[model samples]
Target: GRGQAPATGQAPPPEGNLRARLTSFVGREEDIRVIGDDLARARLVTLLGAGGAGKTRLSQEAAEAHARVGGGWPDGVWFVGLAPVDDAEDVAQAALAAVGARDTKLRGAAAEELRVLAELTSDSDPLHRLVEHCGRRRMLIVLDNCEHLVDAAARLAEELLARCPGVQVLATSREPLGVPGELLRPVEPLPPEPALQLFADRGAAARPGFRVEDDLPAATEICRRLDGLPLAIELAAARLRLLSPRQIADRLDDRFRLLTSGSRTVLPRQQTLRAVVDWSWDLLDEGERTVLRRLSVFAGGCALAAAEAVCADGRLDALDVDALLGSLVDKSLVVAAPGDLGADGMRYRLLETVAEYAAERLAEAGDDKEATERRHLTYYRELARTTEPRLRGRGQRAADRLLSTEHENLHTALRRALAAGEVGELLCLVHALSWYWQLHDLRAESRHWSGAVAALGPDPFA
Candidate 1:
């Protein structure tokens, strides 16, 4: 039964076993529709996002939806999983197996071609065979988890698109395949309504008769804290058998460990939130890893200047910060957005789960966490002091907007100041942020911090 090809008349196992997922799919209706539209037009469409952001799940749903509508992929859909692959050379073989395309003849031809076209050909080339095998059939192929073998995946997609005009590829990866003419659809977190619905559906699985509407506010809070990440929300919902929604929300501050227990039926990496992140983390180069660990000192996100200030240590360089950050962003470990943090044009952030993992790594590397924190605090503190004067008179609104953007960082700095018992530092932050607090109607918080300063016996500066 093992080595036999399907009988000449057999239908070839209904599109290559796209893996019968055990969990119920929820949300992403728009993603499905948009991706389906893209697939109809483009030869290669990649669903890109951070790990656990549901790129694979969303792509699977999209492929199924496209198939249901008969979007011209008539030959069949095939799924090539790259998670189990380590070397790039293995990519072609994995793809051939997924499509049930015999490569024995082509393998021999490839060896001979390498001898003839020694300077122009690759040894053991599988892409050429795959392209020839599928040349006559219109089909959809899903390349799952292409981050580790991005270059090979890109090359394959490029060649397939160029040679096999009848082939359409829908790929899922943390980054784009970077091949020409690739359409990228970034998978984002589920919206609140869909997120809550997903939470309810999975929660009921964990505990029958579980109702989300009973404590709507608490349930909503849980989704918000987890950033509506589907994997995280699913993991949190799985704990409904033992923990309340409120309890889940409360423990999310240490979510790296809190959300570790996931359903056993999924992949080992998918079995825990941390494991999913670890899978991606292991793919980074040393430079990217070092930058990510240092960037964890930030709370919300930081400007390029702020990241360079805190992250440029012995292991990383200030000059290389931009390139390193770009690489992290490319891998979906760091997120870049247009914001007011600096003149560098974009702000970057790690997902909360990712940042927490980086923090743990920073601790493990014997890196000085205190020194990193101090640098972050010092940078933001100086930023606040410099911006305080600018917040007055004509530049008030611009200064206010800038401070609003960095509000989380400022609060984090103040918390660090309090924890370190630095009375003078606390006073400076409280004074600098006073107008910002008043502008934002945070008088209660202002009063609380000022009260703490008042209880410090005497002004250290005085």
Candidate 2:
């Protein structure tokens, strides 16, 4: 049977009648329209995109528009932000409390009271109640930042969809919840034209005479460089309040270094795109941080097998990579992607900014960079050597996966070895990466490393 409503024989508490208000919405008209249409149709929709893709903003805009359209949902549009809550079960309780579920009547022993409250709230659970409440009435339920509590969100959403036939759900997350009736709206970065307009508009608002002329081209270039991500562009604009557009452009030339300045008013996580990423990084445990720093060696995505080979040391056992990698994904630091490597099944990649941050930490640790480089070189070199003979065999995929994952770190190690006069190690790594270089059309790098190795007076091994 469908779950019973609150046992508090009393009537469900009064709905907060608070009209949804749009604080601000920018550069996502198309997204707003798409989601607004879904809400009008009472379809369950999920907005899937990377962090800072403005999923929350889009969801808010959809809610406001639905409210404006002749009170689309009779129960009224309700928003439950889940970013602060970590525990899954607590997520449901928070949602209930947010929607005005009264706990006064839920009395008994602590456990029994909770059970009573859960049942009471369960029936009045806005999502559940929204169905009967809808009865040809229309309402919108907005769940924001649900990636952290996806299981709970999924269960709640499932329950709501099954019970609340007339209600529409609009959720924002970094990924999709694989539930029936879920329509995925993939949010892309802002297009160049609107992105430039947004930057100019915001800049003018911040500084009255901020013009976009010769600097317009530079500004456009800056926006393009940031991949037209709104949060990144806005951050670059905020710096203009203190720096000239040209100066901003020049600084942005090294985005990893320059993008650190954050907004004064925004949450630390939302200050700059980097800070947003750092917030996620700061939440990781020591083991997770160690795994991330080592994994940073990989420029492209890597499979679990390659990760185990490269990141695992005496401190971290081979078996620990899976659990650690899963944690990283949960923290949104490392992202999983599809892989061509058959046995490993999935591949992972670090964002460029995250990789740079990890690399900086790796260098700052005062560990013997050379020794670490040696371990890195030797691991990849042996991997290259073993996999080279089976270029067309099953082993080729594994070898290529390792080489691709270790490409940047391998280059950095090779350069360091060459600088430090470790000629033998450099030669071994160069030879091992040969097949990888060829397969990935990185012949130029191979040629450069080969030339560097040859410049040595003699093989250091000799």
Candidate 3:
């Protein structure tokens, strides 16, 4: 997800927002191929991910690689950024302006044909005119940041796909476009190796001769804590001009404060980690917001049943937790693993950075913090109490696997219970987990919690 990896040799010609990247694009070789393949067969393809997870960078690279390969898009690859385009109705005009730039790069009959399109920019119905022009042209139109005006983006994509015989679309959105034939591809966070490579690459770019191996552990931890998000990694790398890697890693607890001063040229949201998340946060409705913040109580992620128990009351009132959680997942505010729990059991999580954002929201919104956590504590403690017996015989393996997945939640509940001076709940939790802990050989952790249960009181996150 390196935004500006320096690709070797002749790169795709720059156009619209797809400037020939100044740096070699990193770690999306497979993605580029997949996108190219998808576009070959599908008319509409949308890249989906949490904000700041490199959807834009990946889409741009994929589109560029497709164009670089040639023969696929004879009219060229075009990128139209819908981020600054505020209204749905204006999507057509913004697109016309973007694709109109294509005319300048063409020659002969192709150039003349697009020149006709450039002149039609002022048409009374720009969409129809634009579609009529593209009706037979083989081109890749990259609709960037379409989540905010998704309905319009979807409608536009649908019309183009249906009417234009040779047009293909590559859209980057936090959510799916919901168009019938649209392909949704999730751009995940970088794994350890690539995340470290990205950090080292950006770190050296920020400060000449900077090396990640000089302080491998700190750099590793920084990437790990940032959950391998490229924008976050890039922002942290920028701090190398001033701070040591250790210093940067140490201050990441206040990341929104420390990871600042990104390149001022990009959109304000892309310029800062907080702003990037804020853009996504602003897109959510109140129910989605509530479920998101409350679910932040889970140290890792939790099953839907656990989410319902912990987040469905309070201001959520009669709203269905399942639907709310699903909406959050659709919006990319939450990540769901469909098979983690069982056939139909989906486990959901927020990215650690996004969890921090949700925690901040929880604190800012007030009293729901304690109420939601209390429910979380109650749910896990009761789960422990119930699962205790199941740990003994015929059900031991099933129970152990389930509890293992929830071990972080159990530990989280133990700490929260201790902080709140709920000695009674703490005792029950420890007593229930005592054998499970020993079974998993968590001697030290067992000792720590068993000791804490005896010593109770103070210190837990809000």
Task: Order the candidates by lDDT, highest first.
Answer: 3, 1, 2
Distance from true position, residue 373, model 2, in Å? 5.2
Could you tell which candidate, 2 or 3, scores higher by TM-score?
3
Put down candidate 1 lDDT per residue, 253-336, tens digits, no spaces.
888778877877678888888898888889888888888888888988988889999888775678888788888888888988
lDDT top scorer: 3
Model 2 worst lDDT window (10 residues): 1-10
Candidate 1: list runs displaced more than 4 Å: 1-16, 101-124, 340-345, 438-443, 454-462
lDDT (tens digit, per residue) of candidate 2 on 1-462: 001111211332223333334233467766666666655454678887656667777776556654554434555666778887878877766666554332423354677656754565667354454344434545567878787678789888887677767667788876566678888877767888888887887777667888777487789888876766677777777777788887887776466556656657556667667666665566667888888887766656666776887777778887897789887775556777776655556889875556667777677656633344556666656666676777667777666665565565567667767888888787777787777778878778888888888887465677
Error of 3 at 1 (Å): 23
Candidate 1: give the clashing pairs: none
* Cα lDDT computed for each candidate against the true fold: 0.81, 0.67, 0.85
Each model's TM-score?
0.86, 0.67, 0.92
Which regions of candidate 2 deviate over 4 angstroms? 1-44, 65-74, 83-137, 147-165, 174-197, 208-221, 224-228, 249-268, 272-274, 282-287, 315-319, 338-347, 360-376, 383-410, 431-448, 454-462
State candidate 3's TM-score. 0.92
Candidate that would win on TM-score? 3
RMSD value for candidate 1: 7.2
